[model samples]
Target: MDRKEMECRLHERFSWLDSLDEQNSVLGLVFCKSGWYNLICEMLTEIEQVYNSKNLQLKSIDLYEIKEKYGTMQTDVGNCIPEVYEIVERYEAKSEGVCEVCGAEGSLHDIDEWLMVRCEKCFHERKRRFYKRGLIT
Candidate 1:
């Protein structure tokens, strides 16, 4: 799944994500790879269930950002319950062992100072690209 397709799925399934399309919206875009698509969807589903169970308005929660940083997933949300935070944290931590490219079992690697999680195949493919670009010798 590409970013646009994944994003469309999220927006379509979660009306609470309405803010993502607005101007001046913080983290207005999904800044991550397709590999983590299922992970993100799962996280959002759990959050939605939590809100539904508690009779909370899902739109009341503001999703500020969702991105990858330092080889893990990160979500910045506002006005959500504690369970939401916990769920995000769990998924973020889990991202460390999942490939950012192909979603296979992976480990964190630093390629020319860029931190990313990748299985051996994706890692080497990225390294090869860098070498070809003269970014690495």
Candidate 2:
């Protein structure tokens, strides 16, 4: 199939992902475009990576063949991908009191203790600005 056709098929494959229940079970019949089964699997694998990291499972319906046999009902697809839960997990893993400016972790290097505990990037920028103004030797 052509690129547009392939994209449409992929879109249809993912479209069915939305109507699934919270438990990941299919709430209704799933469907997709013809000759794009592998593409659908690839997309599912990508989604699995992000979801698996957060210990969450994504429910998917294998409707590639079904769509080929039955055909797609709608032409336009919708935006309904599930939220990436791994980001929250990653954020929670960060050290407490970490400096948002410089990524420095620990209360000892906090702004109150050192005037400012900027991250390495921010520190360099500040120094560059200070030298430009002849404020520091």
Candidate 3:
């Protein structure tokens, strides 16, 4: 599914884990490429399982931000146990090998000073576009 669909699904399934005021803001959204959709879903599902097992209350946990940065997934959450953070970190590390453009095996690359994880095909395509745009040689 696309980002919008993924976001909606997350909200529908795990809305209680999110903060109240920020629910409609950009910070509340999952900000990442379509490639990481499955990874994100898996992470959240595990988190939900843990949350339910622990009997956490609605709105007690705050999933502040979910985004990609420095070629890795970054999830910012609040009012939770360390295990939650650990789960997020594990998926974040896994994202390093998954393409940000296409869900394929990939590695980190420096393109026009931007760090991103991309497979060979997506990497070369991005490079070609960058060169054409005078962003890179």
Candidate 4:
């Protein structure tokens, strides 16, 4: 079948998984289409080239386990994985803040100096003093 038809069929068959907002579900549909089949195959082969270029760690897990847990065998296996953006936000929050430039704690400052968000205490001290000097160039 054509890509559009394939996508339509996949979507119709897997509407419930679509409700879960799973990336793999979308990827699976894209991967299975005649039009996207070659593209996604290449994309998967060179996934690192598109994102996470360095230190690529391509791996696969058992779909049967996922099917057993979620009762569907589509790409998402029931859309259980968290969104990438959410995971990144959680990581940032847990990591606290260190200076991106100098690795100083609490020294990171915004351009306007109005917000003193989570930085290390030493970094904040420097930023506060620097703000007073008008030398935060």
Candidate 5:
């Protein structure tokens, strides 16, 4: 899903998120893409109870999916609050190597100049399709 949709759903699930956005619209926690959103959502849902109870608020933090060579990936939480950051780290560690297109086990494959997490079969198929569409040659 897109960032706005993700944020809207997140705000709905946890009303406290809206307050965080109001507090820091500049940062306004945004998820880059599939590489991070689902995992972050799961972690945030789990931690929401404690986070709110402790009166610890998450300011606008940007979580990014870092592209690397096949099989390994990384994410940067950009110096957010310690508690929220810890959850980000946990989910991101898993997402880095997971395929972005399909849920199958994958690695960040470099097809031409593009970076994507795709299994061997999917990677080849995508490359072929891209070539046919003149997106890659």
Candidate 6:
């Protein structure tokens, strides 16, 4: 999904995202896909709620592929917290079998020899959209 759709979903789930922005707790938050963004925020929200850390801040949350076989989530909370990495690992494991482009049951597919776990339906949808936008030739 696009920015508006992502923001709409985020706002629906956790209204604090906007407030966090105003409080300067969220920085450099951009370009994250909708599902991944939700997963990351869900983790952080749990941390914030459990620790009750009023001073909590997020430095960054980045997702990238590793060797075309796995995906990684790099998150930096302002302060050290226990079990946070473990929680991140759980989410990573969950993402592995899921489509990166859409939250569907998907395994890796080779597109131009690049591996991506996207369902056949979304694969076609994304391909069509890209072609229509002249992003593909």
TM-score of each: 0.90, 0.25, 0.85, 0.24, 0.57, 0.53
lDDT of 4 by residue, 56-100 (tens): 232321111111011111232222223322433332342234332
Query: Evaluated with TM-score, which candidate comes out highest?
Result: 1
Residues 5-92, candidate 6, lDDT per residue (tens digit)?
6555555565444423554444333344544665656765765565455454433322222112334334433334555566656766
lDDT accuracy of residue 46 in candidate 1: 95
For model 6, what is the C-alpha lDDT against the true structure?
0.53
Index of the highest-lDDT prediction: 1
The 10 consecutive residues of candidate 1 with the worst lDDT sum are 20-29
The segments of candidate 4 whose C-alpha lies over 4 angstroms from its true place after superposition are 1-81, 104-113, 116-137
Ranking by TM-score: 1, 3, 5, 6, 2, 4
Q: Tell me the tens digit of each residue's lDDT in model 5 across 1-137.
A: 66566666666775544334454443345535444455556766756655567765644545443333334434454545677666656655676556665556777777777777777778889899989999885
Off by over 4 Å in 1: 20-27
lDDT of 1 by residue, 1-137 (tens): 77777777778788778655355233355889988888888989999899999999999888877899888889988788899999999999999989988989999999999999999999999999999999998
Better of 1 and 2 by TM-score: 1
Give me the runs in candidate 2 sitting further than 4 Å from their true place.
Answer: 1-30, 59-137
In candidate 6, which residue pairs get closer than 3 Å at backbone N, Cα or C atoms, i.e. clash?
none
**lDDT for residue 54 in candidate 5, whole number 0-100:** 74
**Candidate 5 root-mean-square deviation in Å:** 5.1
Per-residue error for 84 in candidate 6, Å, reads 1.3
Lowest summed lDDT across 10 adjacent residues in model 5 is found at 64-73
lDDT tens digits, residues 59-119, model 3? 6777877898988889988788888989989999999999987889999999877999999
Q: What lDDT is obtained when candidate 4 is compared to the true structure?
A: 0.34
Between candidates 5 and 6, name the one with more favorable lDDT.
5
TM-score, candidate 3, is: 0.85
Native-referenced Cα lDDT, model 1: 0.86
Error of 4 at 101 (Å): 2.6
